[model samples]
Target chain A: MNGDDRWDDDARAAYQLPIEGEEQARDRAILRLRRESAKRRTGMGAWWVDPDGLRMRPALAAVCVLAVLVIGAWSGAGWMASRGVRAPRPSIATLPSGSTAVTFVFRAPGATRVSLVGDFNGWDPEATPLARATTGEIWIAQVPLEHGLHAYAFVIDGRDWAPDPSAPLAPVATFGRRNSLLVVGEDQAL
Target chain B: MRRLLALALASSLLAPGRASGDESEEARLRARLKPELATPVIEVVRSAAAQGLPTAPLVARALEGASRQAGDEAILEAVRGYAAGLAAARRALGSTARAAELDAGAGALMAGVPEDSLASLKRARPSGSLVIPLVVLSDFVARGVPVANASNAVLAATRAGAADPALLRMRERIDERILRGEAPTGASREGLRELLMKTPGTPKERGSREPRERRQP
Candidate 1:
């Protein structure tokens, strides 16, 4: 209120700001840093680690890999087994001469009736009606013969001449057809 | 002891002949063998004949040498037995019913196997309507189908049309002719292949810049 020069230095110093506590300023600066860090941490949400979580993640991944490998191996093995294993194809059975039983098996699903036709009965289809076996699909017959190699075919449905499904096939003169060849060894029975 | 000494004396006397190799001895044995060997030879002949195979030459050769050889009765008899077995086999298989039955069954039996495998099988098991079944199977396998499918397809085709039976008959005839040493002509072969291929009706013409025969893709 006096506005005089007597306390000019004191007035100027009073008008100027005083230095604050260093500890307090440091505390304020630290508080601001912590707030910023909290905001950043909140932005990157918490990924808390459970007691067994670390072990479980790797264990699950390993189990998944193992399962895939096992499935793949099983599939591969099954495929190989299916491809490798096969049935025994039908073939001629030989027996000693004058011994009773000769059998033939031929597969012809489309044919209604199948008969054996060859030289023994002068190639008569009607004379040799082959019996069907337990499988019912195959045309089988047992007829006694003297002992020799014979040429033959399946007379299907009384009309069509078809070769045996299990016979040794030969390319014949007729397009799309084959003949069966059989050899009966003497004294070498089935 | 006396018999043993006699046998020694005989062997010593024959030692000079023993100096010869197997071929000479075989020949000498052939020359001195007897008729007792006929049984086996007949057996062999029967077996071969059963499949309508000609074992005559084999039997004749065996007998020719063995019968002349008064050397070993066993040799002659062995040869005859071989012939007999072959003959018996042939006779057994020669029956029309048996052969037909064998052939049809074989088509199915050889399914899913390769030709080489079947060939091995043939070697191992020398009986039945084998060669023909194997041939069909082999052809099918070569054409990319499993043996089962090939066999089934063939059976189906064989059952299919007006010409099916005729074709089957022709196959038998052709086989017989071949066995008798006749050479098959191209047209006949083509016809047969066509039948086997079962390409219903005439082969269709593929669109042609090149003729179908010349086209390779």
Candidate 2:
């Protein structure tokens, strides 16, 4: 805009590159461009190496992206290799030593389905399905009951309830149904 | 808003014959309560049951209320509050979460753990049942462990493929350390960090150090 301002701007630009200073880089780029221009009369100078030409080559950009992909892939492979995934075991429920092995038995004459529902399985109806005897009217499942008081009952035909006949006398109001009470770790577990 | 949306979703998704089963359950529940206390408590259970919220905690609330000799209105309000809490817990823990997980997770929420942190813990252990972890986590916080620190400890153990037994062991160790006069925050922070780092593939978890992660302070 003004002569003094132009001079100040140029001076400021001189110190843009602190290590080598902008002036030195500018001088080197100009020298290289002039040498190339002199060697060939008109159009021999390449775009990448000229004083005001493109600062980075398309090749460099490709290389950078490739390097990033390579590093990312390498790390991802290592992560996959290190992750240990084990299948959920169907039996031998393990939690604490004090936990008791409780055998839940129920008799349903015409029922096609029976599951042992309780506090131990988060009351998940599907988590602990009972195994029915081939020729009998009984269903049974042995589950590891955690150490503490648990309320449970048998769910029959999905929505129907059939209380365990052998459950203790104490009946509790649970899920609007009577749940059998069993305290694990009593008598040091069974 | 969340409650209304959930209720609408659940009601719309219900099978035609569901109400009969629900009606019987409700009737049985009412039969169990005193006449003066039956209406409100049953209403709360019906609302929660309609939304597919776990209904056991509601009944347990009534039983607890009766044990405490609380007013009928108080029992209803308590059931309603717990139902809402369970809904929030299920939302955070995901739809596939088991009833026990929801029960324990609700306890965690009541103990002051944030819903998003519970979500993170669930996401971290995509396969394990989080019920025991959540129960132990809530217990730790109740016993004076800072909420964040307790959450972090649970998350770490779950990520390490620790199950109910391992979690119980970790809880015992942490509680013992706390009883020895060490601060809960410090004990959980360092103890969980070390345990997680030793978990085969989880060594990389040591460095994230996200300030928002449920941990000390």
Give the worst 10-residue stretch by lDDT in candidate 2 chain A. A80-89
Q: Supply the TM-score for candidate 1.
A: 0.27
Give me the runs in candidate 1 sitting further than 4 Å from their true place: A1-100, A174-176, A186-190, B1-217
Question: What DockQ, between 0 and 1, does each candidate earn?
Answer: 0.02, 0.01
Please provide, for model 1 over B1-217, each residue's C-alpha lDDT reduced to its tens digit, 9 standing for 90 to 100.
Answer: 9999999999988877544432343343334334455444445545555546444334333533332233334444434443443344333333332433333233333333333333333333344344333344334433344344343333333333314233434344444444455543322343345454444653433111122221210
- Sliding window of 10 residues with minimal summed lDDT for model 1 chain A: A80-89
Indicate the fraction of true inter-chain contacts that candidate 1 also forms.
Answer: 0.05
Backbone clashes, each candidate: 117, 2
Tens digits of lDDT, candidate 1, A1-190:
4657658867788878666697799999999999976755564333353332233577898999999999999787455333321112233344465433566666655566878776454455677897764545556677776555455566778767665533444422222344555544432322
**Alpha-carbon shift of residue B162 in model 2 (angstroms):** 3.3
In candidate 2, which residue ranges exceed 4 Å CA deviation? A1-190, B1-28, B202-217
Q: What is the lDDT of residue A30 in candidate 1?
A: 100
